[model samples]
Target: MIGLPAAGDGVVHAVFVALGIAAGIAVFAWEVRRRGLHDDRLWIIAGTCLAFGAIGSRVGTWWQQVDPSANDTLAQWWMDGNRSVLAGLVGAWIGVHVGKLITRYSPSTGDLFAPAVALAIGIGRIGCLLTELPGHPTGGDWGIILTPEHAAALGGPAGVGLHPTYLYEALFQIAAFAVLWRMRDRMRRPGELFVAYVAAYALFRFLVEFARANSTRNRNRA
Candidate 1:
């Protein structure tokens, strides 16, 4: 879900993304209540994360070009730039601290967000699976084969079985969510859970990239 949407898939992608956000918010609220966090300022922090995350997702890829002149204008970037989950995560982390500063709220929020984020990403990736390029050709018996039109739209090979990379990521995230949910209270430190989850995902993503059909990866292979 970190790339451009396929032609006419934008609305569908947005809907799933909205659903993911709703799910994340619901989980966050539930965690807050469960933890007996009475402070209303937590909502402000959550809102800040959402706002900054959205902005970061849109703007993160704008600087891919080294020359400023080669980059899109800010407005153009917002409308057409590639989005990235990692950027959104970084933005959310920054938002947490900014929100804390504004409201003078203290205490780590990572535990509450860890499972919620995992679940949200797991759901959000379904949209990507449906709408984006699946991945490179698998050269094996099993994978999704795109119709000619879908292949053309998504920049994939028609009739070729391709790795469902997004689905792989989605499954990983869902499993991580389950694991994080079970370990939610086991961690003694405040931010350790979040750090561990993010680090694990980063490693997973790096490994998964080799199976992806990204232009950069293709170029590297060449």
Candidate 2:
């Protein structure tokens, strides 16, 4: 058992999430400056993504439960710490299009946002690794082992070596960031790099789900 400290988990998660957002914005700004494109309209797209991403994160897992009654109320869901990154990405994708439509900025912003998104996910996942359910048992010597209290709180088993799925995701994101950074200037199209990154991540996440505690197999076993 890794014995993660459960105290102030929510606060720590929030802090890290904020840091991720700030880091993403900083990276975006740096990219914009490096490109030397002076279109103030890009900010509007960024703002729109932020607004929509927030909404998506809140509502993404709203229907995850088979029984509607088992789900959180809208108000509770909004106030709670729970979120869905996949849904948030979908929302941001929508936001980018809507922002471009509204601003009439025809250029592809995907390449600019790609690395930033990867870096943000890399940092944000640390919060999840610290506070959320680790994952299914590794059946091996290596893995996180939570305290009984923490395990109960996170809804996982105690005294078992659970897969550190979140850490795996964090590492994946970091690797994605590196790959994106290196390929940024080599893509034939402006948005091809972003598309490639998203596609790769989608596949990676699907495979990683097998080790995640929230997977259908794990839930059934639970």
Candidate 3:
């Protein structure tokens, strides 16, 4: 995050993001195809929402962590992993509604994605854990042991076991999936389940931060 020329901010991570966008689109596309959404517009609308949502989520995460004067340069602050998933969730909502205004898609599309987005969150948390990135790392009883590669990637001196924050997030996301699944059909509104999921995930993250190593995150990664 610290060494990129404007390219990092520009399109340096383009491929990775495109892959993520494609994956998200593919998820929505699978839904559309499975449900027989013959309206090509549905694909367009879903694509637009997922695309903008991904950008907004990552950018929002970056924006939340950026504080000028905290670092000599903006990039320094913005590159930290301390971005806001909450903001990204909001972005996803906005992207869907805005795409609806532009494409006339219905809220049902958002409903279609309710469980999906949660699954993605749960999946992405695994990426975070595999790298052995820093976290609270308390009680050795239930944490992870990293290989030399993970340690090197995370700047650990090697032979150290981290708190396994990625695993924590993954487990919590699984719980979130269960709760949302149970509530999806019983809720009064199409989006209520999603709101509950967001709130629940936020609480989960807040609680888990206590086990993370980044004291600043433990203090304030929300």
In model 2, which runs have C-alpha deviations exceeding 4 angstroms?
Answer: 64-72, 215-222
Better of 2 and 3 by TM-score: 2
For model 2, give the 10-residue run with minimal summed lDDT. 213-222
Which prediction has the highest lDDT against the true structure? Answer: 2
Cα lDDT for residue 196, candidate 2: 98
- What tens digits encode model 1's per-residue C-alpha lDDT throughout 101-204? 89998989999999999999888888777677778888985787877777666666777788888889999999999999999999989988898899999999
Deviation from native of the Cα of residue 27 in model 2, angstroms = 0.8
What lDDT would each prediction earn against the true structure?
0.80, 0.82, 0.56
The per-prediction CA RMSD against the true structure, in angstroms, equals 4.3, 3.5, 6.9
> What TM-scores do the predictions have?
0.92, 0.90, 0.66
Candidate 2 per-residue lDDT, tens place, 102-133, comes to 99999899999999999998898888787778
Error of 2 at 185 (Å): 0.5
Can you tell me which runs of candidate 1 are displaced by over 4 Å? Answer: 1-8, 215-222
The local lDDT score (0 to 100) that residue 51 gets in candidate 2 is: 85
